[model samples]
Structures are given as structure tokens and as C-alpha cells.
Target: MNSRIVLGAFALTALVACKEKENKNIVEEIIEIEEVQPTTYAEISVKEGGSWKEGTREYIDGSFVNVDEMEVPEQHTDHSWYIRYEGPGWENKQTAYRLYLDWRNAIDIFGKKVDTLVLPYVGTDGFDSYHNEAPWGQDILKAGQSMGIGGYGRFTGDTIAHFNEVEKTHVKVDNSNSSSSVTIDYKGWKTGDVTTDLESVISIFPEDRFLKAELTPSVSFDGLATGIVKFDDIPLMQETSETGEWAYIATYGVQTLAGENDKLGMAIFYKTDEAKAIEGPHDHLVVFNPSTKTQTYYINSAWDQEKGGIKSEEAFKKDLQTKLSELDNNGKLE
Candidate 1:
């Protein structure tokens, strides 16, 4: 009887040890999965080991080098090729975007065909190689003279004024496991008689294609606005969320630079009370009210070629409605 009792005790101890080992293995697996998960990123790659010309707006004899922050040179402008992709770019698994970082100050989209971080390899082959389609993606928007998607500007009555008159511009990038952001400081921005400093933070998360922009001006002034570029063939669609606190101006059609057959959808979500919808010469403008406080808005794009992307106008509208409902219920997107 004593031997049997001892054996029973030993068996119980062995069972307990096995259970603990099982739990430990489960915890380790969870940790390993978390460690390998993909994340968002932001960066600025500039031409290094080179010097700017004394009298011309050119960067001479340098290779491209990545940096965390940069001050826009006085001579940097569109097609100057001083910066890779012409500015700072940020990306999540779903989408990517870059700012012109020069006088154009326009935002452009990079439509991804795969769900991986690809900005580091972009523009590495050539200055304008992103214009053509590759295995990853390409510069999908023609921006032209427009603000691109949700780029900010001063709505000068019938037109929009870009960052052409800023005294100085500085850009910095921040990245984390869950999100990434680009912060730009525009100093001494002049529009007609008004000159004020503006700081803009554009951020993206790991799961969504929409990017949030928070704009804070040093002083209150009218005409502060953001918008989606206008195409002659694509009609503008507007809708207010159920709560009427948020609204969006969107466009859907084959407007991508990839090709004529590639369809794209773009939208700008804004607070109803803070901004009024208006039509500008080049964009569908959301003109904000005069206020010194920071203003918040969102920009998003849907490409037909993206993985499980919105392929039809009906589906795109449904997705937009779902996003609107989310904002109405939560006052923010997840």
C-alpha cells in the first residue's frame, strides 16, 4: 500500500510538470509570432557625398543616402533629383505615399501590389524609375498641378497656393511597430499678404490605407484647405456620415499614371463644422475655417490591383460608408 501511494504521488507530480511545460511553449510561440510581424516605416533618402552647385539648383556627384531628417535646400524643386522619389515617403503594408518636399508640396501615392515594406528599394534604380510599373508598384498619381490626394494649400478664391513662398522647410520621419509618420514644418509661408508658420503631421497605421493629417498653423487665417485632384472624366461624390460630424469628397475612375486601364479611388474625410466643401480649378477642395488650432483630416486610396482591393465603384462606396460609420461611432478610426 505504501508503494502504491508513492507511485500515485509521483504520477501526479509528473502530470503537473507536463502542464507547465505546455503553457510555457504556448507563451513562447505567441512571442515569436509577435516579433516577426510586419510594421510601418518612413524615410528620406538624399544624394550624399556630393555638393550643391554655387549658382545653380543642382546636387552634383553624389550617391543616394537615407536620412531621418532634412531641411529642404533652397534650390530643390520638382525634377531637381536631389532627393529620392523627390521627398520623404512613408508606408504600411497596404499603401505608400511621398511628398514632393519642394515648392510643389504635393502628396503622391504609391500603389502596392504586395503587402510588404517596399519603400527602401523604391527609386533606388533610377531617379524616375517609379513612374513605370515594377513587381512592387509605381507612382500611381499624376498630381500635375493639383494637390494630389490630401495635400494642403491656401485656397486663394478660385485657385490654390502651394508652398512656393515658404522661407524654410524641414521634414522628419518617425516609425514604430504599429505606425509611421512624417512631420513637416513650413516656416514663413506666404500667401498674398498673410505669412504664417505651419506644421503638418501625416501618419499611417499598419492595417489601413487611410493616412491622417494634422495641420496646425501659428496664426489664424482663412483659405487653409486640402483636397483630391480633379479629373474631367471622373465625377466627384460627397456624403456625410450618419452622425453628420464627418463628411468625405471622393472620386473614382481610371486616373492612375500606371496605365489607362488601372482604376483608382481617392477620398478626403473632414469634419463638417470645421470645413466647407468647394470646387477649385484643379481639385475638390475642403476649405477649413479660420482658426489657429490644429485641424485634422484623413486621406485614402484604393487601387484595383491591390490585394483584395476595392475593384468596383460600388464596392469602393461601400467601403467608404463603413469607414464613415466607424468614425461616427468611435470618433476615430482604428
Candidate 2:
């Protein structure tokens, strides 16, 4: 009875969510820009040797805002924290991933100054394919991936966190291309060993004003109650609606603590945005080793329709094998 009620509520939410039409003026809704000025560029220093092409505009509060579109240089790597001095330096005003003032203490921990840290920030927002997860979703209030690190904006009152006894912070600045981005490598910290974690809502590409489809890729505390375990390989399909646009997304990739290594795989799919009705054949595949629990989602991005779908599952398997071998060689897999 409890399961049935949960399913009923879930179904109702899904129905209600799909009922609303997508307003075409999505940009107008999110960017609260009073005036749309021509783009310009600024050079800002991010401590971890990461450089960004950022832009600034005066916000309603009269503070200059770094238009949140900073682009990290393609070659920039080597740090996990990012910080940018948009208006000026830390003493003036800046934004960061983890900032702490034991300044030298931060250097000892993150191997750099506490002021110029860069954290990885990847969002699949705005794009039709990646609009409902992580960087794009409100549900990502905290890390699906956690650490011994805790507390943000604690002492000294900046966007900083003290982790592993290290104080950290971030900053963002304008880049040369008139765009904005930050850089931080996915280093430091193990894969973690907690047996179970929960992702209440998963989204790939999220909008601040829309209810996107939610998915639970891994077995979750909630998904398990209904006997739906091991949902890690589901493809995020782009299906078309009657309203003349392709919609629907599944985001959030959770993993059982024990099944983390078994849950490795890639997603293969087409990059085109062509619309397809509900009855269209599958355009993606997720090949996996059920025993080992490794899987990859493959999308048919080629123009050659004949070489797509499960017909190419064998090829995908070979690819997965090669990847696994490499990972094993690197001693990255458990």
C-alpha cells in the first residue's frame, strides 16, 4: 500500500510537470539583465594557474557581476579549486570555490595560495540534452559525492570551506573571449567507500524555472523500496512532444557503495537535435558487464543510421573492454 501510494504520487508529479508548456523566452526568465550590452573581456587571476575569459555587467544592486560565463583555458589543469577576482582582488570582491585566510595554511593543503582555488563546475544546462543535472539543477544543494570536508562560509565569512583540516576558497574572473569559465581538475579525494547514498532528484540539464524529468541512475534508498535497483545504465533519451520540440531528460547518476566499480560505462548517442516521435527506434545503447556492474551508455551520433542501435552493441563492448584495460593498467579500477 505504501509503495502504491508513492508510485501514485510520483506519477502525478510527472503528469503535472509535463503539463506546463516551455515558454520560449527562457533566457529572459533567467538573466535578470536590465540592459543587454555588447560583450567585453577582462583578465582575472585564478590562483591555481587557471585563467578565465570572463565578462562583467552592473547588476540591479549596483555591484558588477562576473556574468557567470567564464571559460577555463583548454590547457588549464592541475587544481581542484577555482577562484576569480572579478571586480578586484580578494580584499575588494571576488568569487571562489574554496577560500580560506590561513592563506599559507591553504597552500600547504591545496599546494597553492588560499585565495585562488578552482573547483570543478560542470553543468548540462541550457542545452536540450544536458539541462537537468548537477550544475543545472536546484536539487544539487550539496555534493552527491562527499568528503571529510565540511562547512562553507564559516569563519572570516567568505565562500570558503575547511576540509581535511585545510581551509579552501574559490574565485572567478573574466576571460579574453568575452565569455566566462573556471578550471579545476578532478583530483584529490578517493572514490569514497560509503555503502549507500541517495539522490532524491537527478537531472542532466536543469532550468531554474522548469520541472525537468528526474531519474535515479543508481539504486537508491527510495528506489529500492519499489524493487527498482541497479538503474545505472538508463539512457537519457530526447523524445519529442506534440508541441514541436524534443523534450524529456533523465539526470542524476547514483551508485551503491559496493557497486561503484561495477557501474562504469559510457553513454553513446547522436549529437543532433532532430526531433523524433515517441515510437522511434532506440538511438542509444548502454553495454555493460552485469556481473562486474560496469556499463556504458552509447548514443548514435553519426549520420549513418545503419551503424547505430543495438546492432553496434558488439563494437561498444570492444570499446568498453579497451577502456577497462586502460583503467586497470592505470590502477584506477578496484
Candidate 3:
């Protein structure tokens, strides 16, 4: 019953014609903006949920007045013992996720828009506990694949190093793109001989069940580990592209917002273009062996109660397939 259904589950380019290559100069002059702006953002975070109003804008994170702004606290109001920062997070109408400054890289699960646009800022209302939402939801990322629970790790051919100690952590919010992005920088830590300075940029779009994660290690290493919280009795269903191009690993069923063994799904979609292979040092492992140091993957969680009816394995699998297809065509033009 302590299950936290992590539904973090929630970018792009341009195309030009060969014939238009010669007219590049003219096109650049005509197109001043170059790209379209995102309409939706997690710009509103509320402490006292009510009619959206304006104030001095309490914290740097309390932007847009109504919600989703980061503000500097007048006093040290964050009372979370296990968590320190004001929970720099991003969300859409469907779901939300936050960071804990206490070492672990797992996300706090906030299923369903409590008040549609406002999320009661954790530290503001003197609410200082852990990730378990009172009646809202529970912690979601069960680390279904590996025990890492979406944490960063360095895996040699034989050994694995998970940086569980925190020297310091930096969390910030960015809305400069088509989607709202929360960047977490876990700096100055070590696991055995290898020290990992890792940065994870998680982007939550307007209406997405999954978030895209671009993880860059400050140092070179072998394989990077990305995984779901592995549960024993729940079981897992993983798939790999026959071409060795990508891998999809996920779980559904009984994993709901209320921990009712309903339909809640979590997954990691890894692109293996430059990968050696999606090797597993453990049963819960979803290792990505990238040709480069930067490893990119998609992480998401889905709740049946949060959305319409995505709480079953069959429906969840269908959604995962669509997500994988979208990831497969992320760059190329139709």
C-alpha cells in the first residue's frame, strides 16, 4: 500500500527543401522569428488554492501570478526535512513531477490537476513531509525496471556505480522553449572510483503523458542507466526494435493513483542508434550504451484515474506503442 504511482510520463526541428537551399538567404530574411512558441506552460503554482490573483509574487517560482513561477522566499519557509528546495517542477493539465534535494533523483507524483492550474507549493502552507500526497496521489516512480528509480548511474562491463550521496543540488525552471522544462543538476558526487556530475533536463509539453530527458555526464563513462521502479509481483513487459534502433520497457496494471492495482503505467524509451546494446546488469536494468557521453531517453508514468481510462495493461501498451513511434520519428520531416 506504500506504492507511489510516479506518472512523470509526459522538442523538435525544422525542415527545408533542396530546391530552397539556394534561397536560404531570402528565407532567413523573410522568417524573422524562425519558430513557433509553445502555447501552454506550467506557469502557475499556488499555495492557497483559490481564485488566481496577483501579489508581490512570493517566490521566484511564483511567476504568471496565477501559477508556475519561481520566486525567492522572503524567509526560509521550506520546512521539508528530507527535501530542501521549493520543489522546482513542471506540469500540464494531466500530471506533474517535482525534485527532492535529498540526494535521490526520483520525482514526486502529483496526479490530476488538483485545482486545474494551481499546485499547492509544498513549503508554503507549512506542509513539510515527504512525496506522499495526502489525498492527491502517492510517489509514482517505482523504479520498475532497475532499482535506480530514474537515478543516474555508471555501469562498467562488470560493475555499477549509483551516486546516492549529495554534495549539493541545483534545481531551476525554464520556459524558454515550446515546453516548460525543469532542470536538475546533481553535482560533485562519487560512486566507487567514478564521480558523476550529471545534469537532467526534463521537458513536459502541453499535453503529453511522457517527458523527454536529456542526460549529460560531466565525465566520460561506459553505459548510462535509465530505469523504472521494479516491482516483483506486478511483472514487466519490454520490447526492442528488431533493427536495434530503439527499446521500449514498461509496466501496467494495479499501479494506479490510489494504489488500487488499477491501470498506471511507467516506462523508459531508449534510442539505440549509437548504442552497443540495451544491456541489463540486473533484472530491473534498462541500460543505454550510447556512442556519445550524452544519453537521451523518454520517461513517463500514466494513471488511470488521472486521465480517462489508461489504467489497464492493454490500453497502456497501445499508448506506449504510439509514444515509441513518435520517438522514432522525432527528427525527420514527413
Candidate 4:
């Protein structure tokens, strides 16, 4: 009788354990199915990596990614979703920023997207930490960056320079008119810390003008700076029947999680003839830094409608000279 009781108890315990195990298995199976269901059928593509803010995931076939937040909305597709990630204080302790472009519009300018359309991520302190309200007004820049509007062909150059007065890294770019030639001095660019010297020269035609822009930055990663010069056939000014040409000159700093601090400086030089030719106003200097998620842009507001009425040449030279002087004071100009 005792043996029978013991056997009965053992059997009962085994049955209970089996039932519990079966229930647990069922629960686990359900969880596994749920986990796979969300992402299983999604098809996504990254047109350009690291172009948006840090956490940006997918860029639709032909759409724009929001630069301020580095977000791409999920389109209504059967099995695909795209997302960008980043918010306040994304790039280190500093606010994160990105440049956006409509892919369709950009493709029209470049003819095709190759290795040239992208600009490296930049981090600097002097750039504006705010966001632009309108995409139409923000048309001057792209996600990466493009240079020169196509037809006339623009120039681009980049180098790593130091602001000796203060400790900073400077990347200089020069844009020349169609007729002139530009030279870049790349002897001192390095992938490590410790400052160096860099210079970029641009030539322009008598009918065209030139502008020199620089971004002085402090970066977190350890890598070499890769600068690109590309001609983008995008129309910036729609006033005339002319589809203007522009060039995107860029220099990329190493990626970093800690925030970087720096300044942006630019000088615009106008050819005597081009300066004298009255045309709509244009931006003399452009700076786009994704780490800061901001752009420092300079425009020559002093335009003369009457031919030769404005001291365009004198004013431009004076402007460039003054900025160069400031750089000198800051020990940035070489």
C-alpha cells in the first residue's frame, strides 16, 4: 500500500511538470513568432550611410530625409519602413544637424548618383545650432554635398589648417569662376591629432567671381580628412532663363561621439569684370556641418542694379580682406 501511494504521487508530480513545460513552450513559441513578425517582410535601403544624423536608417527610393532630426518617414509600402534617429544633443553634448535633398531633384542635377554626391559629416562650434524652417529656402545644400551647378563647372579644394592664435582645425575651400584655375596645397593633412597647415587656391574667369570658405573644427575620431570636389548642375537662381552651375567642395573629419568645437571663416574675391557686371545677389561663402547640424552661409547683399554703379569689385575685395584680417588676428589665415 505504501509503495502504491508513493508511485501514485510520483506519477501525479510528473504529469504536473509535463503540463507546465508544455504551457511554457507554447508561450515561447508565441513570443518568437511575434518578434519575427514585425521586421520579417520589411525591405529597406540606405542610399547613403552616415549622411543623416547618427541613427538614421533608411532613405526611400527618391525622397528627402529631414536633416534637423535625421528622420525619414516610413512610406506606405506593403513590407518596408525607413527611419532616422537623433534628437536634441545627438552629436556629443552639442545639438545634431543634417543637410537634406530631394533624391529625384538631385539625380536630375548629377545625371546619376555616384561616389561624388555626398559630403562628409562636419562638427564645429561657430556654426548656428538652430534649424531651418523651409526646405525651399534650404535648397543651397544637400545631404552629403554637391559642388558647382553643372553647366559652367565650379571648383572645389580642401585641406587641414590650424588656427595658431587659438587651438583649432581649419578646412579651407576655394571656388573660382569658369575661366580660371585653382590649386590645392595638401602637404600637411594628417589622420591624427597635433595641428598642421593647409591651403586651397581657386582661379576664376574675368566674367565670374570666386569665394573662399573655411571650417575650423575639433573632431573626436582618429582618421584622415577626405576632401571632395564635385560639379552639381542644380539651378539655384531662377530669375534668368539660365540653369546655373555650382560646385561642392568638402572635407570630412573622423566620426566621433564626443562633441567638437571650432569656427567657420570665408573670403569672397570677385574678378574685376564679374564684380562690375550687375547680377542678382549670391552667397559668397557656404559652410555645412552635420555634426552641428548647421550651415554658416555668407551672402553679398550689396548688389547694384545699375551696371557699374556699385563698387562691387572694391567692396568684395574689402570684404575678403577684412575677413582675412580677422582670420589673421585669429591666426587662421596662412
Candidate 2, poorest ten consecutive residues by summed lDDT: 202-211
**What digit string (tens of lDDT, one per residue) describes model 2 on residues 147-202?**
10111111111122222222122223323222222221111211122122112111
lDDT of 3 by residue, 151-246 (tens): 455565664455455465565556644577766676776766666677777777767666777788787655677665555576777776545567
Evaluation by TM-score, superior candidate among 1 and 3: 1
lDDT for model 3? 0.53
Q: Over the full model, what C-alpha lDDT does candidate 4 score relative to the true structure?
A: 0.23
**TM-score between model 2 and native:** 0.19
TM-score of each: 0.89, 0.19, 0.65, 0.21
Candidate whose lDDT is highest: 1
Model 1 scores a TM of 0.89
In candidate 1, position 332 carries an lDDT of 77
Once superposed on the true structure, which residue ranges of model 4 sit more than 4 Å away at CA?
Answer: 1-136, 141-314, 332-334
Question: By the lDDT metric, which is better: model 1 or model 2?
Answer: 1
- Candidate 4: tens digits of C-alpha lDDT, residues 70-117: 222332111122321111111111011121111210100101011111
Which residue pairs show collisions in model 1? none
**Model 1 C-alpha lDDT per residue in residues 169-242, reported as the tens digit of each score:** 99888776667788999999999999999999998887878999999999999999999999888999999998
The per-residue C-alpha lDDT of model 3 at residue 132 equals 55
Q: With candidate 1 superimposed using the best TM-score fit, by how many Å does residue 293's alpha carbon deviate from the native?
A: 0.9
